[model samples]
Target: MRFDKYNKKTRAETEKEMIGCLIVITCALVYLGYETEWGTIRL
Candidate 1:
């Protein structure tokens, strides 16, 4: 009983994409966190 009639994406595929996005976001967040910390110390 899928309500999404127009989109045909499967659950596994969606989860994989979501995980990939999360990985990228996490990496960016970590990098930014470290950069800000280092920048504040260097100031």
Candidate 2:
């Protein structure tokens, strides 16, 4: 029973980390897109 509780907690933490990573990746892509667009306009 204690092992089951520990497993559940670990899964929750892993999910949170995955979500955080996805958000960071999305933001990075958006920033890169804007930078590329501006670079083209400037050129």
Candidate 3:
């Protein structure tokens, strides 16, 4: 029972880390897109 609780906690932490990484990656992509010419629109 204790092991199961520990495993659940570990999985939750891993999920949080994964979410944080995804957020960082999304921000980096946005930054790069703005800095690069690909994400631009001209009127």
**How many steric clashes between backbone atoms does each model show?**
0, 0, 0
The local lDDT score (0 to 100) that residue 9 gets in candidate 1 is 82
What is the overall TM-score of model 3 with all chains considered together? 0.56
TM-score of each: 0.56, 0.55, 0.56
Candidate 2, after superposition: displacement of residue 16 in Å? 0.3
Candidate 1 residue 38 Cα shift, in angstroms, is 15
Cα displacement (Å) at residue 31, model 2: 0.4
Clashing pairs in 3: none
What is the lDDT of every predicted structure here? 0.69, 0.67, 0.68
Lowest lDDT block of 10, candidate 3: 34-43
Summarize candidate 3's per-residue lDDT along 1-43 as a digit string, tens digits. Answer: 2446557567668778889999998787776664445655322
Q: Which candidate is the best by lDDT?
A: 1
> Any runs in candidate 1 off by more than 4 Å, and if so which?
1-6, 34-43
* Pairs of residues clashing in candidate 2: none
Tens digits of per-residue lDDT, candidate 1, 18-38, equal: 899999987877766645544
> How many clashing pairs does model 1 include?
0
Rank by lDDT (best first): 1, 3, 2
